[model samples]
Target: MSVEAELIAPAELGTSVVSDKGESIAPQAKEAASGLLDQGDAMTSLAQQAPSVVERMQDFLLVGGPVVWILLGFSIIALSIVLVKLWQFALLRPESNRDVTQALALWRAGEHGQATVVLKRNRPVSELVYIAMRGVLNVRQDMDLLKDELERVAALRLNQLRALLRPLEVIATLSPLLGLLGTVLGMITAFQRMEAAGNQVDPSVLSGGIWQALLTTAVGLAVAIPVVVIHSWLERKVERVAAVMSDSVTQVFTGQQISVVAEPELEELKRAA
Candidate 1:
């Protein structure tokens, strides 16, 4: 009986030891696995966040680029000038074809006052017709004197038309030079910054200065191109008007009904002015 009890006690002790070992190892293994899972999650979060940070930086540069702002400013000023000049030219048409027929009718009717009234009422071409009519008014008008006076009046009217266009020429001439000056200044600044940074400088550190340099050049061209185009168009319009005035003056002088007679008083008046 004593032997049997001792054997049973040993078996029970061995079973209890096996159970304790399993309990300790199971909790430790679970904790290590949880730690690995948390580390994987943190790594994935960092990977996703990195692309977002880079994309934000790219967006900022694209929108706030210096070149875009410079171009915008150049376009606004140049286009504004072009639009105003276009409106001015539209308003400056020569006297209508009807004016020629109407003036001839007034001359044939032997009513000089009504003819003068007709010429005066028209605004744009009034100055040209007014000068020619003055020649007709003289009792002794020399053909040479009449020709010279009409030419002078035509030139004066053209000068008035070209009054404000000098600024357009100035902008066309100076814009490129101003851009070059800006480029030179930007380069100097960039070099100074590079020198200060020494070996630590990245090439991208000079990107702002480079952007400024390029933008100034582009802006200069933007202003110059349209000014040149509009200036040429205006010059052609002036030429056409001058030709029309010349033809009209020639017709008036060559008409046999209007005789040319030389007057000494008219010559004196022209010389005094």
Candidate 2:
């Protein structure tokens, strides 16, 4: 009887352990399933909302009329120009200082070959520096003529940077004016409708028209403000590049002049001695 009781107790202990593990695993499984369901629900809600958001934007644009469409075009153009200019600046690296400084130092040290190699980068400033160094060493041209050539090249480079800027300025200037025109036209149409309605004039109708008319001005200003700021910022960048080019080129010439003067003075001193 005692042996049988011990064997039965062992079986009961094993059963209790299995039951406890099962209870713990069941809650964990339920939690995992609930979390997956929550994620699926969120994804489904976002998918549904996406189309509605797009529809709202389309409706808003339609309500703003032709003027808004034109503004949208201008905004696209401005964005494209901005992207293109950014790409150009990145490729050209107009503000690169380290290589320019190194090249200038090499030039001043009379390592003309090394200076030319250092200025081999495909940058406007580097090009100008190389040309100046070459003109002094190889061309042996008069300083004045070389300076003139440098000036011309600098102008050409600056003009390249200034490209597409006029269109941006035009867009900024014309946007607000176009919006005002749209508002005027819209108001006139609303008034004509009110006159046609005579004594049955609805304030809601007038209010809707006025708001729609104002929408053009709002869109126009939105397009113009950022464009103006961007145009100014780009102009500043170009100006800075111009300054760097001028400074670097001037330093090269100035170093040449000092060397030239030193040579004559050194010869004169030797003769006097």
Of candidate 1, the 10-residue stretch with the lowest lDDT total is 253-262
Q: TM-score: which candidate is best?
A: 2
RMSD of 1: 20.2
User: Which pairs in model 2 have colliding backbones?
Assistant: none
Indicate which candidate wins on lDDT. Answer: 2
Which residue pairs does candidate 1 place in steric collision? Answer: 140-261, 141-261
User: What would the per-residue lDDT of candidate 1 be over residues 179-236, giving only the tens digit for each residue?
Assistant: 6766676677778888999999978869876875666676667667877788777767
- Tens digits of lDDT, candidate 2, 165-190: 99999999999998898888889888
* Model 1 TM-score relative to the real fold: 0.55
After superposition, candidate 2 runs with Cα above 4 Å error: 1-30, 262-273
Predicted structure 2, TM vs. truth? 0.82
